[model samples]
Target: MFEPIIPLVLFAIVATTTPGIATTLSTASGAQFGFRRSVPLLVGSAAGLATVTGAAAAGLAGLLLAVPSLQLAMKVIGSLYLVWLAIKIGRSGPPNLDVTMARPNSFLGGAGIQWMNPKGWAMGLGAAASFAALASGPMQLALLLGATFGLAAAASLSLWCVAGMLLARLLKTEWQWRALNIVLGLVLAASIVPMWRSA
Candidate 1:
């Protein structure tokens, strides 16, 4: 019983820690707003991802897999959204430490990202498919996967936020800030490859 769960835990860790749109946004939010104010975004993202995981466990992932058209549609929409987000990040100016000057991402916005993020969908689908045999029933599997993913997401997002805050200190110059944003934006845009391939 526990043996099967070990692999699931490892998968969750890897999936959550890997760079994706959610982590990218969390990093950007932390750089601009610091860890304190970015809490809601992080929380919302985790909740949204957990919900996705639950849906996957409930067989939505299988449904998507059976319908290539739906999967392709999701990929296209998610990729376009990521590209848009990358553009927004690339255009953003230096962070104003004064919270009043620039607002951090809102909770709803963060949740929305996860809801549409291709990586999040992939993670949830992979996790459910990989670990479905471990549980005795569907509800049990859904709860198990959702809880594990939620915890992993919380930890990974917090780490990314902290890393972003630390990087913010080093990005004092305008050029440094611009360079960082450009790199992050490019990385976000690059995620489209896997999404396309999966389709």
Candidate 2:
């Protein structure tokens, strides 16, 4: 059981560090609004993911797996959303610090996007399943797994966001900023390949 925790921890770390809605949003927020303002969004998303994963471990994922149609629905919905997000990212321009800084949508928008993300649900469920298999007691194991994964996710995401902010400082010119957005967008778009193939 204890040995299994190592693999589980690695899985959580990889899942959290992977570029997706939460990571993208955090990076965007940090690049635009700075880390201080983005903290709430990070915390909220981490908390939400922990709850979702724990619920999945408690048999919610099993229920979903049992329903073929529901699983299909999730795949379709998630795929479409990922594509939409890629398009949105491609269209995004450099952060207008003045405008974005004044925007109130950062925190709630970041958290909401992550909460609805289908890939996130899948990952959470998968993590829950693995943890459940090795856990001696369900609730205690879930809590332990949730806390460990939650912390990893929150920290990794915050680091990504902070990195984005730091990178923003290097773009002293408009072209550099636009180029950065384009490159990041391209990277994110390319990431959808795995998700599509999995679907």
Candidate 3:
């Protein structure tokens, strides 16, 4: 049991810490709104990821994976959404840390991103396939996987948020802010590579 659990723990860490839509948004939110205002988004994203994990453990992921048309549709929709998000991020100006001019994302916004994120779906499917066997019962495995992914997502997102906050101090000028936004946006856009390949 212990040995099997170790792999799941490692998988959770890697999945949560990897540079994806959720982490990217969390960092951006922190930079735009600061840590205090970003808490809701982080919590919402964690909860969303947990739900994804549970769905995967319950075999929804497997069904989705088996259907190529659904996968293609998801890829197309997710990619389009990501492109829109990238455009928004790129156009955004440097945040006024003293007085936040740009509004932070809401809890619903955060959750919605996870629901539409192809990367999140992939992570859920991978985790369920790899770790579901570690538990004695189906319900136990789903709960365990969900909790592990949720906690890991929260912790990892918090760290990214802090990193973004630290980076905010360096972006003092308009050009610096624009450059950072463009870079972050591009990085986010690049994350759709897997979806492209799968499609």
lDDT of each: 0.70, 0.63, 0.69
Quick one: best TM-score, which candidate? 1
Per residue, candidate 1 scores C-alpha lDDT tens digits across 142-189 of 788888988889998998888777866676788887776677677656
Candidate 3 at 45: error in angstroms? 0.3
What's the ranking of the predictions by lDDT, best on top?
A: 1, 3, 2
Candidate 1, residue 45: how far the Cα is off, in Å: 0.2
How does model 2 fare in lDDT?
Answer: 0.63
C-alpha lDDT (0 to 100) for residue 172 of candidate 1: 70
* Candidate 2 positional error at 73, Å: 20
- Model 2 TM-score is 0.60
Q: Number of backbone collisions per candidate, in order? A: 0, 0, 0
Give me the runs in candidate 3 sitting further than 4 Å from their true place. 60-101, 168-199
Instruction: State TM-scores per candidate.
Output: 0.64, 0.60, 0.63
Candidate 3 whole-model C-alpha lDDT, 0 to 1: 0.69
lDDT of residue 160 for candidate 3: 77
Model 3 TM-score (2 dp):
0.63
Predicted model with the maximum lDDT: 1
Worst 10 residues of 1 by lDDT: 93-102
